[model samples]
Target: MECAFCTDGIDHCHGTLVVHPDGGFAECTDPGCADLDRIRHGLIIDCHAVDPGCGCVPHGSLGPALRRAS
Candidate 1:
């Protein structure tokens, strides 16, 4: 179908579908999207120090909402 990482849906999905040796499939050609996906899945740790400009801090929904309110 489309890249799961593509928040904008198939209309904007530019990644190609890729299948791994384990039969896992993913549509990821964008490096940033791939990194975010990995981080979200806990496959890679978010390095705040290295990417201090990152707005996606992995805070749960409520936490970010509360912070934004304050």
Candidate 2:
């Protein structure tokens, strides 16, 4: 999937999003670009940052996707 910050190619399997106490959000495990931090609260919900386009299957979708990966 395309990185929201860098617009570079990324695999969802290798990506992670972290939410800070200051209501900031960051994408880690992504090299080069600085982490993205949210300026406002509620911009991110449940820390649900990664999406399918980034090649990451949601935890809810993991079972089927993992089965396929196997």
Candidate 3:
């Protein structure tokens, strides 16, 4: 599966779901991300981070790939 945040090949699923009271859904594996805001109304989804060799911290989001600092 392709990650929604980074659009990279997903090796594994995080099995976390953020659902709104109004029937909105967002899935994510990143524990650092706060889904409470999205759960209120909108949906915020986080995906497994892909190592792009940028040498950044291994966050569940694409922090390593998008970081300017190496």
Candidate 4:
């Protein structure tokens, strides 16, 4: 899931978040945010963990289209 701090390119903070399917945060970027969420809700921020991507799109469909358009 996109961090509320940087969703839609908003706050410009960038980091990978590991979110469970049930809306729980397994990892987060911001220090203050991570600490607060961890203490309050048992949310964790495993800095070593990396988020690859949401995998919504298996591959880039735009590449071919853009090449043809150009």
lDDT on C-alpha atoms for all candidate structures: 0.31, 0.35, 0.35, 0.36
Off by over 4 Å in 1: 1-12, 25-27, 32-70
Could you tell which candidate, 1 or 4, scores higher by lDDT? 4
- Worst lDDT 10-window in candidate 1: 61-70
Model 2, range 3-56, lDDT digits (tens) per residue? 453454432333333432344444544464353443311133232333433333
Query: Model 4, residue 32: what's the lDDT?
Result: 46
- Those runs of model 2 whose alpha carbons end farther than 4 Å from true positions after fitting are 1-13, 32-70
Report the C-alpha lDDT of model 3 over 11-55, residue by residue, as the tens digit: 333334433223444444456555434332222322333223222
Higher-ranked by TM-score: 1 or 2: 2
Q: What does the lDDT come to for candidate 2? A: 0.35
Q: Give the TM-score of candidate 2.
A: 0.24
* Pairs clashing within candidate 2: 1-53, 1-54, 25-38
TM-score against truth, every candidate: 0.23, 0.24, 0.20, 0.24
Per-residue error for 57 in candidate 2, Å, reads 28
Off by over 4 Å in 4: 1-10, 29-70
Candidate 3 local distance difference test against the native: 0.35
lDDT of 1 at 33: 57
